[model samples]
Target: MARQDTIDVRELSVHYHGHLALKNINFSVDKGQLIGVIGPNGAGKSTLIKAILGLERSKGEVSLFGSSVKAFRKQISYVPQRNMIDWDFPVRVKDAVLMGRYAHIPWYRLRSSKKDRRKAEEALDKVGMIEFADRQIGELSGGQQQRVFIARALAQDADVFFLDEPFVGIDIKSEEIIVRLLHQLRDSGKTIFVVHHDLSKVEKYFDHLILLNQELIGAGAVKEIYTPEFLKKAYQGSAAVLDDKDGMVVVSQ
Candidate 1:
């Protein structure tokens, strides 16, 4: 059987104070791929994610798993950038991870049951942060903190994931672990969308690519979308894609 589209967006547009932030963007994502949403600074990479998720005001149609976003929100998991979060929230690592289960809890309940705690611990283990479960989130390294966030997402057990710059300010080990877990999630049939900036690791991290610059430039396999022609269009002559032995790398002018 053919794979179904986990994310289907049509003519999605977002504007700010009469300024067009995104224009008639359209794309459909299949299940089980690590898709990189890439573009230059202020290219609306994060805006597109927010628009699709309905966090930002926009005009268009967005459906996840054949259902409207409102009906399927529980099936979606989002992890915003580290800078957007407060590290000094004074929350324990395990407690933070357990927050993912909040939606799963009954509306009448105020606290998590034993199963929720177990799932949270299991998620922490997956990110190799179980040992730091009792530690304050602010005390961990940048990478460790990022891992803890991913663990929280894992506990949600959602079919679709939106990660905004999870690799930023993270260490090599944390990136490696996160990427490995992402691949495993793909293997298990979950679609993951990551807003990434570094061009060097695009191919290494994501097989699928969505090149955006206030609009859709191209969306397809990395080999098809990650080229000089597309990069030029997306960056508007500000970035130069160079030939690298590993693949292609981008250098800003």
Candidate 2:
């Protein structure tokens, strides 16, 4: 039997002030796959994700789990870039994570239930941030903050996860933790999409890849998409491919 598509995007396009950011992009992700969205700077990687999430004005069709994006919005979790978040938000780590449960609870209910608090605590513990639950988000290091954000997303208990530059400015340990969690999530039959910049770790980190350059360059298994040709096309010849004993390493010039 064929695998079901967890995410489907067709003819996706995005424009900002008449400037084409993404054009007629198309891709589909199957269940239990970790997909890396890669491209050069300003190559529409973020735009594509935003369009698929319906967070930006775009022209295309985006479906999640065979349902329209709007209908399945709550089933998806997004972790934006760490730099995009205000460091001085004055929110505690647990409180920040508890925000994820707002969708499941009605606004008329003033307080979260015991189940919600347990879920938030579990998420924090999974990310090794339980001890810092009461700490102010602004007081944490960049890597710690990133982990908290990821915990928040995990607390949502969404089937689909989208992360943008999650490893940026993060410590090696944090990156390792996040990658391990991603693999664990994938093993549990969840679909994960990460907007990543480091080309060197793409092969080791992701099973699938979506190459973008204001359009769809390629989308498939890592072995097929992480080739010299696709790298050159996406990075405009600024990428140099080196073959190693394990696989390939792409270094940007």
Candidate 3:
């Protein structure tokens, strides 16, 4: 028996105005897998995500579930970094989440259908934001705002979810809740790819990892790739590998 690939990225490279960001990257993700991409700042983690979403110009091929980006659009949902969206946009929580359904609705129609509205409310409730439906987007806290965005993505009912820095500024409780929701999504046969910043929690959380540094360094199971040696290379980018405590290696700065 042969297993099919969920995400196939080959020879992927990205350049920003002639500045090379990612170089000759390649990776594959299977269905129902939760992948965590980690690297220091400017290590091209987000660049890979953007390229896959067709948000940036790049040289490579990325196919989701054996389909092109155009065909895979409907099955993929994205939760961008909080900084990318405006908080004071005058949009209510309900209306903002309903935006996910606009792709399915006809442009000629001026309002959301009864079914779409129901789905939107259900999505908000899933993220525990149902009561905040009437509140303005700007009135919520950071974790609440993140949850609303996740709810919007959930309303889309996509098979693949991409999250960028979902745990940037939040308390431990909120982070745990978000992680739990992500696990629930995975159990439902969804694939989640998150750009994570916390290196210490990588082993405690993700099942797989993609470690990068302007190029692919190592990617595989977290237990295998989270070794001290890999961490040293990922964090310091030094060729020398020094052994650290806990039998892990660290390259001194």
219: Cα error in model 1, Å: 0.4
Q: Is candidate 1 or candidate 2 better by lDDT?
A: 1
Which tens-of-lDDT digit does each residue in 1-253 have in candidate 1?
1124667889999999999999999888888889999999999999999998999999999988778889878888999899998989989999999999988998999779999999999999999999999999999999999999999999998989999999998999999999999999989999999999888888778989999999899999999998888998998877887776776678874
As a whole number from 0 to 100, the lDDT of residue 156 in candidate 1 is: 94
- Predictions in order: lDDT: 0.91, 0.89, 0.86
lDDT of 3 by residue, 82-130 (tens): 9999999989999999998887889899888999999999999888889
Relative to the unseen true structure, what is the C-alpha lDDT of residue 86 in candidate 2, on a scale of 0 to 100? 89
Residues 79-119, candidate 2: write the lDDT tens digits: 99988988788899999999988778897999999999999
The alpha-carbon root-mean-square deviation between model 3 and the true structure, to one decimal in Å, is: 2.8
Q: Local error of candidate 1 at 175, Å?
A: 0.7
Candidate 3 pairs with clashing backbones:
228-249
**By lDDT: ranked, best first:** 1, 2, 3
Q: How far is candidate 1 from the true structure (C-alpha RMSD, Å)?
A: 2.2
- Clash pairs, candidate 2, are none
What C-alpha lDDT, on a 0 to 100 scale, does residue 230 get in candidate 2? Answer: 87
